[model samples]
Target: MFDSEIRYIISSGQRKKPICQNIVLLQQWLLEQGRCVVCGSFLTKGEKKPFGTGLKIICSCNQVYFYLPLANLYKRLSQNLYKL
Candidate 1:
């Protein structure tokens, strides 16, 4: 498994429109499985993109946000497993 640091940034444009910027270490695995965790929409991973080291997840609703680390995802999964 590949371990990399991921970071996210939210920007508000002049029109009050919100845009998300993600910077993370590029990994082949993440590039291959391009899908938003919240919306289940396909995400794009650009190569050699110097924005910084993680995956960016965006949704059309603009009501969802993810600020957790990758480990947190696994942690949540484990917690749910106990309930099953």
Candidate 2:
């Protein structure tokens, strides 16, 4: 179910457009899996963390993943540009 959705999103025009919605869907599916895709430890949403110019999610096994809304990513990048 989730795999098909993910595949559809990937094979579609998702990347060319904003990806937040698709990313959220993928995240939900990953969480529903109930285990880390990496070390296989039980997966839990960690405290908000950073990933490049976006926010990320961390698992119990310390695997970090890119997980930010498109709006947030744009806002974050704009803010960082101002800091320079």
By TM-score, the best candidate is 2
Ten-residue stretch with the least lDDT total in model 1:
46-55
**What is the lDDT, from 0 to 100, of the residue 33 in candidate 2?**
61
- Model 2, which residues run further than 4 Å from truth? 1-35, 39-44, 71-84
CA lDDT of each candidate? Answer: 0.30, 0.49
Determine the backbone clash count of candidate 2. Answer: 0
Q: Evaluate model 2: give its TM-score.
A: 0.31
**Superposed Cα deviation of residue 21, candidate 2 (Å):** 25
User: Which pairs, if any, clash in model 1?
Assistant: 23-53, 23-54, 24-53, 24-54, 25-53
**Candidate 2 residues 25-82, lDDT tens each?**
5555554564455565543455455666656555665565444456422111233332
